[model samples]
Target chain A: MIGVISYQTGNARSVLRALAAIGAPARLVASPDDCDDIDRFVLPGVGAADVTMKSLEEAGWPDYLRARVVEGGAPFLGVCVGLQVLLDHSAEGDVDGLGWLSGEVREFPSSELRVPQMGWNSVDVKSTHPLLAGVPSDSYFYFVNSYFATVGDDDLLATTEYGAPFAAVIGRDNIMATQFHVEKSGPAGLAVLTNFVNFGKAA
Target chain B: MLTTRLIACLDVVEGNVTKARRFEDNIVVGDVETVVAGLYQQQIDEVIFYDILASAQNRRIDLETVERVASRVFIPLTVGGGIKSLEDMHLVLDAGAEKISMDSMAVKNPELITQGANEFGRQCIVVSMQVKRVVPTAAIPSGYEVAINGARVFTGMDAVEWARKAEAMGAGEIVVNSIDQDGTHQGYDLTITKAITDAVRVPVIASGGAGTVAHIAAAVQEADVSAAIVSSILYSPRMEKLTTVAELKAELAHDYGIHVRPIVAA
Candidate 1:
């Protein structure tokens, strides 16, 4: 079963509903013990980086997630702040992230563009990955964020431009994440989630 | 590049979706669930629901309707009207809403914005303003005054100034609804819309008076707003002609060259 991590950060219900829409058997992982039956994991978040980290830490999710997904080789996905927490650190609240990927989350540089890039924006595919299997070219996804992840070239899966190009989608080994809201995004986003559900399963 | 967002605003009263002209003469359109389900199928970017009577009646928001509607909605859902405290925000958010918009409460208790932003993140807190056009005066330099209680009471505050304050107080977004243009189906009030958009750094949404696809295009082209909210154009049978979100987005892309999310076939 695919497990969607739930906490006080918000938007977990939307993610759960999206999984149900795709005919995927999923349940909310409210605690670390809920991780046992969850083969594929989806961490959906919508809040500040510091707040998301604190809630996850309070619930003892960081170590369990790192052990199961990062080291255990189970497929994992993160959305919005979920994606941010996977990085080494975030400038949002000068807080540390889960450090699953070697990167830092920083606010979009002072520019003419708005700070939190709220609304729909297109994603440019950087390379091939199972998570993007049925996602169309130039597909747009819902984005509501002030910070973007800066990852190494090898980990970049897709890029989108606000003021400057930032990592919109990143994947390394068994872990993948998107800076946009896959659940709120239209059909293209559902396509991404569908691929993620079938990603590591034996064909 | 970020595309312009087209949002559908559902003015709900009691338990059914309704429409009003200039925030009066309410007419029931359809049940909340069916109308929202149709909008979803049309690939609307976002949806906003305002409980029109909750605040005037002096009560909490209708969480039952919110929870029922949110169960089927996959896109971002923003709910406004009757949100009075942090507990109210929690109740609405827990009912599955992505964003909680504060109108009457925000103007009365500015701290609610900061509190909501601090607790739930600024992105989830939206400050919606009801502005009515008035003669230019020193007290109202922008020639527009903020209204509340379904636009029945004028707050004597300048629309542009209030927007700036809300943003400073940690409102992630602002929705400026023109009391005069609402339900008129003429067009958005561009002057005030542009002024507030210029005054704030966060995204501003132009609400009220969306008649045609061109009107929506003008809000982005002339006013430079990040998004536009429409009601009668999509749902009102009383309109001369009804349109779908797909048609609007297509016209926006084909005629106006406005970047909109491509509609995915159902």
Candidate 2:
């Protein structure tokens, strides 16, 4: 069973729909107890960092998720703001993140390019990670954010350019993340989600 | 580089794509997913879903439609049409809408824009204004009166002044729709379009009166607007408007030295 983290942010329902579209049954888990029966976990968010963390804390998801990913060794995936919370810290909020990865989230500095980087853009696939198994290089993905993660380690799987090229996809061990909305990114996006589900099933 | 956006407007009602104009005639478009999939195939830059009768019902956005479109389209989706409060805005955004365009609610309570901006950031909020040209009366001068909920509220506010105020309240962009010229197929109300564009610093989307490719080109060049939003031209097969945005942009560049970015399909 696949479990999606329920917070105040958007994209959870679409993620659930995408999972179901690919013949996978997923449940929306708002609490740690709700995640007990699920085998795989997905974190989906849309808003700022501080508020998202607050929602997670208020709903008692931090403790539950920490136990699920760290102790239970469940396969996990994060999308957009969900990806930001996996970092050590986020510029969007004062609170520290779950710190699943050694990185800090920072805003994409305003320049000639539009803020929020809204629309479909090309992604340059870097590594041979399972999340990007059959995904082509220079494939386009949908992105809508003002901030992204900058990690020290070389777990970056894909990079996309707006004003500047930033890490669009990151993965380490059982935990993976995409700054773009895979549930929204057409056929290529479905391919990435299918790959993630396959990776979870294989594990 | 600033790109010309090709936006697909989804007229939604009761969680479905309710109605659209084809040859100036109302036709029932399919569900949000099917329509969005067709628009995605066209490689449109962005998609806007307007709830025609949502505000009158005093409800939030259609979240079910947002989820359906978000799962299908891989582009920026702006959901509008009954967004009245911050909580309403949150409902749409949480359902995968990239931006929320407030109409009647923002006009009634300007603080909604401020509060929404403070909470979700300005980029997530868009103030949609319906401008109707009104002759100068004893009480009002040569200005446009803003309407909400399908000409429900005739807020004696000047359209240009409202654009400026909305900008001051932290609107990331402004969508100016001319009610008088809507579905006319003649052209956009350039006078009003130019007024709103010059009044605000943010990008202005010229909507409501795009009949042909020439009208779209004229709106972009003469009005100096960032985007020319056309519904009938693209959706109506009987209309001879260009199908691809690249073709239209090229025509505009060739005709008027105005460089417009073409929306490429994924």
Every prediction: chain A TM-score: 0.96, 0.94
Tens-digit lDDT string for candidate 1 (B31-95): 99999999988889999999988988889889999988877777889998988888888889878
Return the DockQ of model 1: 0.67
Return the TM-score for chain B, candidate 1: 0.99
lDDT of 2: 0.76
Model 2 chain A lowest lDDT segment of ten: A110-119
lDDT of 2 by residue, B139-187 (tens): 4454788886676468888788788899899887788888887766678
What would the C-alpha RMSD of candidate 2 be, to one decimal place? 4.4
RMSD per model, one decimal: 1.4, 4.4
